[model samples]
Target: MLKTIMLALAAWFAMAGGGGLAQAKGLAPLAPVAPVAACADLARIDLSGATGAPTRQEAKSVTEAGAKPYCQVSGTIAPAIRFEVRLPLDGWTQRYLQTGCGGLCGNLRIDAGKAEGCAPVTDGSIVLASTDMGHQGMDTAWGNDPQKRRDFAERGVHVTALAAKALIKAFYGRDPRYSYFSGCSDGGREALIEAQRYPQDFDGIAAGAPALNFTIQNSFHHGWLAKVNTGADGKPVLLAADMAPLHKAALAACDGNDGLVDGQITDPRTCRVDPAVTLCKGAYQPGKCLTAAKVEAARLIYQGARTAQGQPLEVGPLQPGSEMNWIGVFVPMNADGPIMSGMFASDTINHLLFTPNPATPYTPQTFPFTLDMVAQEQPARALYNADNPDLSGFAGRGGKLILWHGWGDPHISPINTIAYFDKVGEAMGAPTRDGFVRMFLFPGMGHCSGGDGPSEFPLLQGLMAWVESGEAPAVMVAHRAKPTHEGAPLPADGPMKPPPGATGMPKLPMMPMMPPQPTLPPRSRPVFAYPAVAHYKGTGSIDEAASFEARP
Candidate 1:
């Protein structure tokens, strides 16, 4: 039944693509092509001028029930970069897709992030590939070796694209008519790198929640949060139980700013509610009001990293509506160990961020939050930072870039993405920037997907429409998963809990569930391009996308 539904969706999508906005504008639809080389022959083909002696490990036809047949090729780029490429044996679109990797990528994953609704991917009709970013483990120790560091920084993604396209040509007997890249988080950083450094690699790029300012993000921002939340006893000053009330207060103050009290703040930059307002008046109230120390800690975190002169060190601070997701990062589950933020900061500072590794590793509490510390990251900045805004070459070649970020993202503040977008406009006149780049902010969404607002959207579909037919996306509908139990939303507390034998807090249900049953269609809302917001239309159900329209 599921297969039948997917097949039906695929057919419908193909028909829709045939009559897309491009067709309405009298543009021709891209035609599908056929492969010329046998699957096994891919292993013998050589990639000229490609480094790491690109060697194909296996090339075989993959067959599955109710899905299109495709050639799956796994290979290694010299010195340990692993990648996988999949090419459809039939109904091949004259297009190629390359996916980005997340956080210290050590495994090859070919997901099309934010493009799950794209029929070509759902039906295995497009050529797709992804690399492990030239490393084998999540540990930053690989950065100690200059070659591996270069691979993890920028070389990996670039070389992988070159090799994948070569293989695609070998298998199809022709280069793709168009190519696209999509990624979120660290992958998002790679997408920007491609546009900035290797403009001709892809025709369109989709980046979400990008770790663009790598040096500051992994060091200063994360370290600051870790330091502020840790007490002298080395334990988290803010407890997991504290998140619920804090989040509740934040919503009460700012969730209705967009003229609709729908449990999400449309733009977090507009949220100015201070967490200090929830401080206890006299005696501390558990799970209700914050203590003085906790209040101060939360204040520092929300203000972000700062210099002695009170200047902002990072792009932006933690957002207001993202309070619930801070439990694991700012508040730890264990009593003694470092929190998630500390681990990320320490790994980068000790192994990768600086040129000569620190003799004595800086703990989150010990890392100096000073101008000198910021200067210390310079050696590795060129390799890791993708903050470059100049994309003249890419834009000159008609490359389209889509940037999206979740307004409620607890990791890598969405404000940074906005600032970067604004910088792009400043660098290349707003009119020119608008012609090739578009950014979308998803309200109520977490770092990547889950949150109170709709998160899922047809990002690739929108990108393809823009790149292939010159139709820029104005608004895209994003869907929220059905609540496990309709009308009873899931609790907002993150996955952080006190250790056994701890007291004073009730044991919260990790995941609330209900007996499986048929359910109504998911709620959806329209997400507009930046500077435009969705306004409630005052008509149909607020849960439906049709009930909202984009307002500039």
Candidate 2:
């Protein structure tokens, strides 16, 4: 009975003391009680061979940055988990961190656990960050080593959250009321991993163009980088050069489907143009027409990653509408068309996929995962497969998950994400899935953050609002025609096409990349979670989410 009351008092202290300014008397005091029991080492977080100077300061120093006073902190070890705590001056804002560490995440730059630069954690809320996912050398590597995995209990992502929260509690003398997460690529997968395994970790999450399905996604990259090429005698090269004409055709077919065709296509599903027909037959600028060989090259991309048996290698959607970037001259895609640069698939095969492991340095019996054979290998399937469909933990904790992918993503496919979401609906049923989960398909974007559109929106804001305020993100605006879309960085030679509907259409300040939806005010839509389907009036089988109701 005494312990229960103490626990309840602790909860009150956590929320009321987030800023460490609470004056409540009933709440228990916030402090780390080093265990009197000697079974565990509570002095510091002891890691393998971990010996070093502790915190920068002999004593704790609570400093403030600008208007948002914060708790600047470092763990007991010299370079132990370093972080900053920013608390809102308003009606208490929640704290969260966006993670980016993968493979061997070591250098803990003050960025938002994920973003490269220090994410000032700038917002109307308190945000936290850390870099303890292991990895010490360049790039993410420590994540795969068994010894390191054992030290971490083979669950690195979980530690990111656990450590972050611990830091928050210590620095601010309080616990966050609502927690949220947002990230892309490796970060994206981390977001979903938390939802599936630790639903109570974050209340709401936004995973953009996630590099989920670790094994297959990376493997597929290897297969494409190794197999696809564009040389006269079947050599590997990037498709940038040929990508121009391909982009032109893709736009021609799917541009105005959304109502406008300035140069973007919102719904890539409507695009069915085949670049094969648009090859060198026509006069395309001075010596710029597509050759028969180049035409075939474009066909391969649209076909996506494949395997030895001619079976489709499962993949995910590229960020929505990300294909218009023919910028910079190189090979099939780039104008310079350097041999090394052109072989994108080859590069992936060598670097990310086939790169020899230096730790053991023993050559694997099989080195490359050809698109045709990617699925056959578990390691290869990890790259971008998105196969982990279960999210019971997230559902049980009332965690809201929002994932969006670009239909025309050139780098990563969006179809895989769609497939994963579909499976979630099936497993949990439309009723539950519809409430906790939702996916927004961007018309033209790339990878996770940028491309030929307005990739930056109030994504973090929208997600935070949903988790903290009970308001969900129903309408997300992604424009490929942002004023800065012209990555002036690329040489003028870098090819680019007008956004969809740019076809002698009415002019608007914001370029029309695709047909516009009804100029409707912000709309409210339910996020259909898995296990529970959105019951609706439809003429079809009700047993399956696909047949039971129509997606709005």
> How do the predictions measure up, each by TM-score?
0.87, 0.65
| Deviating ranges (above 4 Å) for candidate 1 | 1-28, 51-56, 281-285, 333-338, 482-522
**Candidate 1's TM-score:** 0.87
Residues 296-384, model 1: lDDT tens digits: 88889889998768988898987988876564556654455347788778888899987789999999877888888778778788889
RMSD of model 2, in Å? 13.1
Q: How much does each candidate deviate from the true structure in C-alpha RMSD?
A: 8.2, 13.1
> Clashing residue pairs in candidate 1, if any?
52-78
